[model samples]
Target: MADHAGHCSSSSQDRRSHFLVAAYGYQGHLNPALALARRLARPHGGGARVTLSVAASAHARMFPSSPPGQLVVAPPDAEVSDGIISYVPYSDGFDFGARPRTAADRARRRRVSAASLSAIVRRLAAAGRPVTCVVSALLLPAADVAVEHGIPLAVFWNQSAATLAAYYHYFHGHEHLVAAAAAAYVGGADDPASVTLPGLPPLRVRDLPSFLVDATGGEHARASIDSMRALLEIVGREKPMVLVNTIDMLEPEAVALRAMRQQHLEVFAVGPMLPRLQLLQQTDAAGDDEGRRIDLYEQDDEKGYTEWLDARPRRSVVYVSYGSMLGYSRQQVQEMLRGLRECRRPYLWVVPRDGRDGDVERCLMEMDDDDGDGERGMVMEWCDQLKVLAHPSTGCFVTHCGWNSMLEALVFGVPMVAVPNWSDQPVNAHLVEELGVGVRAERDAAGLLVGTELAKFIAVVTGDGDEGMNIRNRASFWNQIL
Candidate 1:
């Protein structure tokens, strides 16, 4: 194996190839699917041939160089709609105000959920296998297409299975269990700090991540819930191979019970998906001298972040982002910038473009009051986020706690300050703080993050090793779990 250490094929080491409907306008949805694509492509040691047939144009961008690669671009025939499920070719990716994502936009993004199953069916007809296996994000045409083709289709739950189980239980007239808990703790507010399901252990509302908490407050939440419930119903009655992006050990009980009821459960524990999958592949290919090809997502950007990092100082900066879906009001955006500037911390913030016609760069500078360190607060319209976080100068992450970012922060053993806006964010933030890996921010009774609270949290993360290192130590311990 040493003779051919670096060379590898993109043929997917798995003995069997599988098709994946990998398409999403936003980064959060797109990144995990890419991670799963990478995982499936690597050899599973049993000579199982696995090739991920991603079904979309945006997805094609992710695997541009990787092989056994096929991207089923959105055909012109498929139309777009405002309320219906369809893909509107977003020449420009989704953008919210220089703030967090709004509820309606979140719903619209999820609504543009066209499953290009027709494309996949045709592809198989041309050259691929019988198309027996498929994984999807529970979109409309997903199961219908799979059924038409007589293929076994699995609704890949991108969120935690625990979250799915909660939704299932919620539909069974047991959702109040959470409403009651939220009422009891956060006082009828959507911000339920801790939630416990009947006959199940106590799961923090934060641990459930943000969406479950905020769904009650917004319109997108309803559409997404409808989608999730429909998905769970399909999984509930007829078991399609369910693929969840969580760990067996971390969420052992939930995983166990999910498999108990469902006949076809293949819980990969394959998460923190990007890095954990890499770990498994690296371990499996430990001493193999075979030629292996490079994975595309890990490829360097034009300028290269590592090179950028080398020019910056050690642990001297803060990272800020509201994730891909979350948007903020212009008012909230101002408060956030004021907080960052007041904190006196040099930061790299992903300032959101104003909704429709907003300018991203102008927003960042306007957010700066003092400009004490001109450009000390670097603003990137869109970033190679993973690479930026891995930079040594990055001391803390002020994030929306998307599953991908949570895993990325942990992989780098980087400390974080949490400000969960929506979806699973609240849950992610709670886990980040509760795990001792990241510090938490205090929000008011109305759930708005106080400016001082944001600044204070930032100071703690960028603070000295005595405190920050302690958080990093806890973060490193979790990294070991991966």
Candidate 2:
């Protein structure tokens, strides 16, 4: 392996080399990538010139003042040091316009983004800030550009190390078993079979990522799986390092299997790269001074939820969020509302409004409280998730079990009632159960979360019973380590 430091320091210019970290524009992918970029550009020393890049539309949504197809350094924020790190936008075929609503549009955006990224790299190199390493967030095409320019590319696996290992094994040799298990699970309807991967525990067919084999998974899901397979193939052939957002202790067996079937494979567990606030508070540091959070959606004031939480009893509030992209059907949304209303617990739910679907809004209007003070439950488009998780009043989390949200729940020692939507969430939910940190709620035949089941699971995890206490203790143990 070539030493990266050798390329970083040149005789003519004795400065830190550049690291260009690119995320795929979704909130889940961008947050971890941004945290990693911040680490690379840490103020004191032993840091690099980090420039974070994302799709043009996402960049526009993040910074509305900036125009698309232009590369401009981010204006300095008081909390973020200016020169240490910067953000730039590149064309992803959506020039600050409406987001892509179809698979063909998404595919075109990916192709154009690849070309635009290559141009960005060339321009950066020409300007004397050659990128020493290109870190990509699950986007394989970016790696081709890096290879073309003879620069090392590192994949920042945004999901858990265990999930990555499962995907790798599936591509390497376990396809038949996984596919059969998925089919059996889909066929069984009531009681499904389990798929036993090489390094992980037995996962129910429902727990498998939808992209791998689920027939109902749409084009986007299929495209994601296809892209992931291509990514692993690139890793297998080119042998670039894989950097997973996980810790070794959390998934020892999975981490051990990181290089089981692939040659020249090197994997590093360098994460739980949470936001600045969560990181500081969890580390017992005094700084509560919040910095700019890498959120794509419009967010409410961070203090509102924390103040509301402060008034509640310890471990009494349920924090609910379904991530940035996943959307629920009208039936599903209504069921969740009914569950929260009947659960009789104070809750804070971040339900992002979907412009395409009026059902969510209709349901919200139907369930609006007469008092309008949000006396029992509060719903907003967005909230500071990390701050809410860290609050002492946050007892349980009702989450989609996306890797980032799952990690936040575990790190904060909050028990979970997981309602996994799709794509690696099932695996993450299973891991949560296996680790004894949380419990998975049962879904109906149509995979809709039942109001009764949601209430039952929430009560199970938040109740004052031995099982709940045990789960809480296990969560706390992990949080302490984190």
Candidate 3:
């Protein structure tokens, strides 16, 4: 295997090779991609020049005040830097924040973004900062552009290694096995079915990635399957390196890494890819003290959640957030509120107002009215999640089991009550339980977590019972190791 630095030139004049780190427009994709770029640009990590490229819409949201001229499809002279890493926006055709609604729309966006990204590469090369390598966070167009330019490419798998292993094996040879398991379970099997992949434990049908299990169901599910298939095909044919967003210690057996290695692919575990705020503070560059994390959506500034956390006792607060993308149904929201109220713990909940349905908003308003004193709970549109998770008073995280959220909770030693919805969340929730650091809440026939069930899991995670203590101990153990 080649050393990462070997991808750059050895000549003194061209020593500082540029790396183009491209991520999807979503917050979950952007955060870890930005973290990797920061690590590469940092003095100790590599001291390389890093440019982070995202869809124009996300870039615009991150830097809303930038001049129109600078946000052109491939602005050659536009150089926006956060002191450490440069920022670039490639036109994904849907620059107005509207998602691709159909197959044709997705194809058109891919075509447009591929051209825009190619132009960016050419412009960078002409400006003498040629991208030595392209690191894509599951963005297919970036991979296409990298291949078009003959530059090295590495995939940044932003999910758990176990999830990656599942996808890889599902595509490589075990498709039928996984499909059969899911089909049997869905067809009302008496016992739950499981698929055992190489190097990893048996993953039950319910615990596998929801997209793979329901690959034929919806537009989103089909699209996700297509993307994964495309990504795996690329890795299989070209054998490009893969960088997973987890530590070796976390996945000690290195299941996915080993599986990829057997196929002659170079896979590296480079993760817990979190913002190094302390390291950023020591840098000479002048940038945001928060490690230049790009939040595409507005955050709540009026709510003093942090100050409220400070006043709470140690390990006493329940922090609830369903991530930026997942919106709860009205019933789900009401049930969550009821559960939190029943838990009787001071809770900080982040429910973003954008994209929320009218019914959900009304429920939130009614909950606010009901809790006039705001003594037991505080609900905000959004808050800095890392701050909330790292707070000393935060004891439990009621989360949707997003990979980033799971990593943060693990890093902070906060036990979780996982309520997985879709995509890789179920697999992440499985990992959460497998590690003994959290418990997953069971949903009813309607796939809704009732108030009582939610309350029960929260108590199991945060209570003084033996099970809760064991979960807390495991969380602390992993926290120290990570």
Highest TM-score scorer = 3
What is the lDDT, from 0 to 100, of the residue 466 in candidate 3? 99
User: Which residue ranges in model 3 land beyond 4 Å of their true spot?
Assistant: 7-14, 66-77, 191-193, 254-256, 276-290
> In what order do the candidates fall by TM-score, top score first?
3, 2, 1
RMSD of 2: 4.2
lDDT of 2 by residue, 1-482 (tens): 12332233332222466778888777888888877777766643245788888776677677655564454433221112355577777677766555777878878877887887898888788888888888878876687677777787788889988789779888988999988777766676543546777777667677777678767767777777878888888887777777788888988888766355345577777778775444556444653322445777778666776678898999889899988777767798788877887778998988785522787777766666531677777777898788888888999999999999999888788899988878899889988988999899988867889998898889889888999999999999988988
Worst 10 residues of 3 by lDDT: 6-15
lDDT of each: 0.56, 0.76, 0.83
Which candidate would rank higher by lDDT, 1 or 3?
A: 3
Error of 1 at 37 (Å): 2.2
Give the candidate order by descending lDDT: 3, 2, 1
Error of 2 at 323 (Å): 1.1
Native-vs-model 2 lDDT? 0.76
Q: Kindly list the per-residue Cα lDDT of model 3 for residues 298-373, writing each as its tens digit.
A: 6777347777888999999999998888778999999988889898888888888764799998888888889875
lDDT of 1 by residue, 1-482 (tens): 11111112123323444454433334566556545555544444232223333333443443343343444344423333222112222211232112115666544543333334455456545664444355665454455566566666666667665665566666656677766665565554454435665324567655554445563666667656766676666666656655667776656656565533543433444455564434435644794312222222233342643454556688777888776445565556667777877788777776544321354334555655455443557655456666566667888888877767887788777788887666666656766766688887877857677678888888777777677768878877866776
Which 10 consecutive positions of candidate 1 have the poorest summed lDDT? Answer: 1-10
Q: lDDT score of model 1? A: 0.56
